[model samples]
Target: MKRSIAQLKEWFRRGKYPTESQFRDWLESYVHKDETVPVSQVEDLPRLLNGKFSTSRGESVEREAAALRLKFDRHKEDADDEFEKIENNRQALVAEDERQQGEIDAQQAQINTATGQLETVRKLLHSGASWTTVKAAFDVLGGNYSSLWALANTVKTFLEASDTSDATINRWQELESFLQGITDTDSLTGLLETMKQEIGTAYLNDLRKTADELSGIPATYAELVERRARGGMLPGTLYRITDYETMVANDPEARSAGHPFDVVVMALDEHTLSERAWAMHSARDAAGYFGKSKLEAWQVWYCLDNDDTRFQWADTTRGKGVIYRLIDEWGNDCPYDFKNVQFKRCNTTGDFVDNVVDDADWPNTHYILSPSMNGQADMTADETDYKWLYTFTYLEQMQDVRDASLINEVNADFESAYYNKACNCNEMQAYYIGEFIDDTTFATQALNNIVLSSYDEENGAAVKMYGNKWGAGCFNMTFHEHCYGNSFGVNCYCLIGFKLYYNTFGNDCDGNTFGNGCWYNTFGNSCGGNTFGNDFYRNTFGNSCVGNTFGNYFQYNTFGNSCNGNTFGNYFRYNTFGNECYNNTFGNGCNYNTFGNDCDGNTFGNYFWYNTFGNECYNNTFGNDCDSNTFGNSCGGNTFGNYLQYITAGEGVKYLNVTGGSDVKHFVQNAHILNGTSGKDSKNLLTVGLPEMSTVCRYVGQNTAGVLKIWVPADLV
Candidate 1:
């Protein structure tokens, strides 16, 4: 409402001023002063020498407001500067954030690349790829030391969880340490390859041998056959028969009269002959008689170097004769040639070659007869050196010839060195070649180290154990049979491997399986699934036993019978005793403590039936009257006696020396006193109740009265 002197000048000189009537109207809004003042007396404004001036509050108020506006403008300018400074700080913070974000993105990218590389290495290792292949892959995708370390630790954890052998784990640790300094892929590969070689047969199969070693070289026939049967031989293996004698000696099942020895597995062609280019030819002509049939003379002649067989004895004159081509046992081919040849028949029974008397006499020579003229030959020439020719004939008295019929017959009875016939002896089986021995007719002694042929259902090769009770010490024998009610009635020791079914064992057995629904009428060792009649040690008997009663120490027999009265030894696995097993006496650690089923009146040792058979009977003396007791290492489902008339001694009570109902008496210390009894209980090897607890205790059983007394240690003056 107030106006200054400057305002009055502006109103007088500039267009910002209103008209005089408008200014008087605006002045009407302010208070008027009575006296008039010169503009020169105004303060904080330019002094104006006006002609006349009326004093009013509008000038003062206007001057004061203009000064406040100037102060407000300066404050606003300072606030704008502060805002600019704040904005600059914000821009700087944003730039810093962007720089950090870039660094974070780069680190994240590296992390992703490392993670992918580790995953690739993990997959490659898991696939069992060779170390070389893995190294190649690692080279392709750069790997780090940390990734390899993580992979090693991961593999170690897997091995530990799998219960790998200690040596194997140690080897892995050694390999890890060996490669710890190297992170280069090629270096790791080289070190791993060296380690692999150092492991040797620990990783390699020992059965892989050289080709010649596996081939049946006359001595290794049995070993090769056994190895082949056990899947140790490579598939489609071919055995070489060096000669006829070797073939006959090694595999007698492959022998036949007159059957080509080398042609069984592979046929001998012209390439098999050493000098096939010579081109030999044979011609048959009428000859003498060998026995009942007439003999035909065979004239064989090999051509000369020209490769043509001229029968006129001109071009084919390398060797020509009515010669006997003889092959000896050592696979030697001998052709006897002369000017001419003739047959001399004789009724002798000796070697034909040994009788080389001049064509007039025949002494030890044997005449061979043939069905046709294909097999008879004799030299009538006076050759004194034809004495080694042995004759094979088809006569009943002579040695049977190696022919096709006999080979077929022998082959029909054998398969892979296992005889399929029913033999009445045990001589050959001792050597493990008699796989299908018919022991029903002849009882043999024990057998050892024999691997019985596996049962073949399709081929009816089921091995039958005899019914007669024979003592057979079968050690390290593997009996695999598709058990068809075959009982092993032989007493055997170390009857190792058996997967039988429905077979009974009648004699004492060890480590065998008496099959399902079979009764074991003998003492056994770790035998399973048989109804045992005799005392058993570590045997799990089958159901439905007949007349099975045991009295001696039944250590670990689990049979389904009434275990009424029986004693046991230590390591009693279960309290599963027999039904009707009352009045049973258990020694030391009988597990089935509570009277089994109906088992009563049984004396038990300490820790008899503890924490078993739903009975919390720990070291207590007795269990409840009639509870279902689990006979540990004994029968499963059989009623035992009741516990009514039995006083089970506690841990200390069993070995305690009980006196007459005296003043609370116990065999305490070295000296037995009446009431205030105390000394050193030196009954145990360690003497207690001494002045010093660490004093050595000596066992001097001076007190004869406390012989069966439990030593009660006490300290008194």
Candidate 2:
């Protein structure tokens, strides 16, 4: 034994690269030396070699897979085209009896193939064979079977038992519901983990117990792995009752070995064994981390999963973030790495080495192993065996050519505008710096040349859509203040000076949340500014504007916005000629507004009492002197703090507003009680006189439900 060891060392020092058979002979000799080394050292030889050598489980697997893949190439290729043709024929009679029967036959054939392959997986896993033997089966598993599932515990690794399965969907449903009741389902990531743990602990155990109660299904060596030696029970293959992390204390998943070496893998195009293995690589790439395991310096071997020639873009080769994994499936290699490029590599350079030996039939292959160009005869390099083992491209690099089948080569008009470009640019997604359609007509018109709204075709009843081009889902997606078009145009929204429109600028002018045409959320220059607009919200959700108004005018059916939750108690003044605001919602009550001064062009002459607008009138301050105008010109939501003045119909008043801050809720609570004044004031669009509520009530007001306390005795202090 010592002499043989010296000879082997001498050979290494001589730089004489031994052939595989020679190396195998030397290894066998060494193992038996001294009788071979000690029993303990003999057992440790494989690990010692694996730890020190560049050759890894992956490399071995690639060599074997490349060889095995050839035997199944022809059958797999035929299957690939057949499936592709079937998939492409959208109107094919796949649903008909004969065609369906044919599909069934094909699918059954594959299923049988998969079943045959499963035996290999079990045989390899049980024997603790190299990953090459194990993955050779998976590479072709999907292509060989109609189903995409892998039940390694089934007969010969195929779906034979039928399990005639006792489905526990209802039980699963109940368990999910139970977990949801106790868990914060809102935290998706956390909840998923919790669900995984809970399901394994409870429902899965129950199912297993039921199986045991029923004398269990057929058992295998895989089943033995499913149970712990201790009293604890566990699921098959993947999980354990005691977390491996907790048990090992040592982290076995640290992969900081440096960048992985590329390896080519061979497999049938239609979910061939190598293809399945490649998919596993992709899955691993996506799963950057696994529980506490750090995946680093990982190489992958992906092959054509669909067709030998055709490749579908999977994604990037490297990931730079943390991804979670709870299992060490495939012994901690990347799970699914079916990069399309890997397929191309195999097809181009790989010789269909169906097995270690070439055969005529596309019968069984060992695994996706390939012949190394410069290596010993009949030997394949590990790196040249699979897909993910090769370089992967970035998404940005492939952006131009990705899925370009529908690309039409049409010439763009030199000086014409298209509908897709109507809104500044086609995409209004976040971070885009283009000029948006929703904005004030005063400023935006100077910046952007195109106008969103248009002049009305008919009597031009304020062509609401205005110059704005209509998009499929662009209703109410406007910003009045940001609109740079002609503000004085007949169709321009609100008063000329004030640019008021829903989504007035950008996509945030946002008045469409309410009922149709209800534009109270429409603010002039302030983007998200309205009396009750853009306030603080509750968590992710916001309070809805339901019932509200400074005066009795903002109701649901009659007005545009909701006036339900106004904090100001019935104080509908200082609106300075805003109109038809039905459905306006106040978070509380509407109060303290000076509904006294510029109540111009209002449909009704109503006023709220006490604070400012409410300070003067107790009943509903109905101001009507000039019989000149209607709705938008009506005097509404005025302030009494500013001295009462005569505002012409259609004119707006700003004196009623405060620059820094105003005590909007000086008088009432429970703002819902203040919802009274009707929007029925059409007669005197002008103020009758500058008389106080004391004098007006005596001569000019109606005896409706106790005047001051008539509508709401609750709001009056």
Candidate 3:
């Protein structure tokens, strides 16, 4: 049987060479044994049998074989042509694949280069390099001019807010100028170097200044006392009564009496005591008891003695004389009232007694009466000359005496209008000038401003301003309004707003913190903690949101904003709404729901979790555990979960849409009806076959009111 040409073509197409036995059978049929063909013709026989050939009658055997040979040659030529075309096509395909792969590799290389450049720029920015240096580096790496310009502006703003030093300000100015005039990369590099040097030096100076400012000053007297008690030295010296006694004992005349004297001494430092002694000695001649000539040695004592020993001086020579009577041991007093009494060298033996006369007939003129002891004697007679005589003793004896004279004098000085105006006096100086009893000038200032008030130094009346600006650690703050605690608003002006905590404000605004802006009808907005927003009309949590704009009537929402008409219930967290959402209502615990622009009129019930709805999806209802439900654009009247419909069927009947619409309704098994809507009487109601028809037959249908009604069988009822 002759094989078909279709079989040969199929074999050639499949690249299947014929078996040797099959090729031999076709060769024998083509050539007769009697007529021996050439060896070349026989070798070509197998090639002839492998291709298409024809066997026709009424021709010689050779002619017929030759015709068949010609046909087989044409088939073999066609097969070679087909093979060549297929090989060429395959090569072309391979080349095209290589070309695509090369393009992809090139794109990947470019992406990697871009990523590396971005990382380099980020590292440079965080390396504390100046903005100019970073910009220059970016330019060297072929960064765009607009990005460099933006970076420069950002750096300028950051530096201005963070650093207030003259060097920083000057460097920023220079950098701004350099950026504006930048024409070449070389100039930019030079500018970057200069800016880096300036910033580095300024940073060092800032550190130094911070260290100095943080090293606080010792301001209180208690601190000085504590330091001295610990055997530590203070910046200034403190004097005690024993120091004064030691100085008096060192004097030869004061020690020669051989008996202890009762003395009340104001023991100040040597410099201060010397200044007071000179002022007192220069005014001693003007004292009433002293003669026209200056005393060889004048000692002024403020006698804190008992009433029995104290005596008052009587007026004698108009302005120049005062006399105190000397009583003897027998109670006999001196004659002439001891007129113009002056202490000469006493003839007595005791330390203090040797300073007085023993004889009653001698005018008893030896000791100088303390101005405090003598009523008629002027203590400030010389430049109110004896003002220290009264003030120094008053300050020393203040602790023992109730309503001490020093307290009245100091309070009087503080109450004076000229107290702050005198010289360039600070608050402490204006109040404490009277307390410096060693200085006569301040004593005069204190005495002139004396006022009779019930307030004493221990009470609130003696409060004085000590420092500038109110803070958590300041003292003596003035002009503070609505302030609390010791240091709040110490030196601040008009701090009258409410709910402040260690924060300073430049202007007034209620219920906001740290940030400065005007809020009109906003509430519960905390601008502290780096969350900043301002100028909200009637939105709650407006300033509390981070980088968001809340329009009017936006309430009970947080996090992302630009929510114009979205009405949210309480407990909404991390929800973001675009500007196109209008009249969208969210229930409690509705979190992580992102509504795109134009998503309007969507009502979400409680616990609507993890849903992402597209834009323009209006009138969509969502319920709890309705997880991963997505709505397309313009999709409306859609109900998700079985919470929105009524169903009372067998176990398999899960979802039913009573109100028919083109929208898709999605629900899970075991879902039941929530609140249903009014619809047709008997729409597409689905039921499932049960195992057995028990006495109970439940069916879901619409009642006369067109609401969903579940009916029960009579036996089950």
C-alpha lDDT score of every prediction, in listed order: 0.32, 0.27, 0.33
lDDT of 2 by residue, 1-717 (tens): 133667777666665887676677676675555464564666677777668545687799888898888858977999999999878675466457678899999989876776576445434434444434433554565422213222322212222233433454554455445334333434433433333343334445656676653432222223322333332332221211111010100112111222221122232222222221111211323333232222223333332112111111111222211111111221221122211112111111123232211321211111122222222222343544332111111111111211111111222432222211111211111111123333522211010111122111222112122222211112112221112221221112111111223322222222212111223232222122122222211101022222222212232211112222222323232232112222222222232232332222222222322222211121123221211112112224432222222222222321121111112322112111122322233232222232222211111222466232222343344
Listed per model in order, the count of residue pairs whose N, CA or C atoms clash below 3 Å is 54, 165, 10
Q: On lDDT, who's better, 1 or 2?
A: 1
User: Candidate 1, which segments miss by more than 4 Å at Cα?
Assistant: 1-493, 496-645, 649-654, 658-717
Model 3 bad stretches (over 4 Å): 1-562, 641-717
Candidate 1 lDDT tens digits, 153-242:
555455456567888789768756643444444444444344344233322332334444443222222343354446554433433322
Per-residue error for 401 in candidate 3, Å, reads 36
Candidate 2, position 683, lDDT? 38
Give residue 495's error in model 1 in angstroms: 2.9
| Model 3 TM-score relative to the real fold | 0.18
Number of clashes found in candidate 2: 165
Tens digits of per-residue lDDT, candidate 3, 1-717, equal: 334556545544666787776565445454444477775666577776688645644357778789999999999999999999999999999999999999999879756765567555545534556656755665654544443444445664555476678987798777556345345443444443454555455446656765643332222323333543565542333222111110111111111111111111232432222111100112222343222212222222222121111222211121111111212221212211111121111121221122212211222111222222221111111112121111001111122211111122233445553222111111111111122323432321111111111112243233222221222212111111111111222222111121111222221112111111212222222221121222112223332222222222222233222333444544444555554565566665565665555666676766554555555566555554343333334444544432322222222211233222111243332222222322222243332212121234344444566556554546364
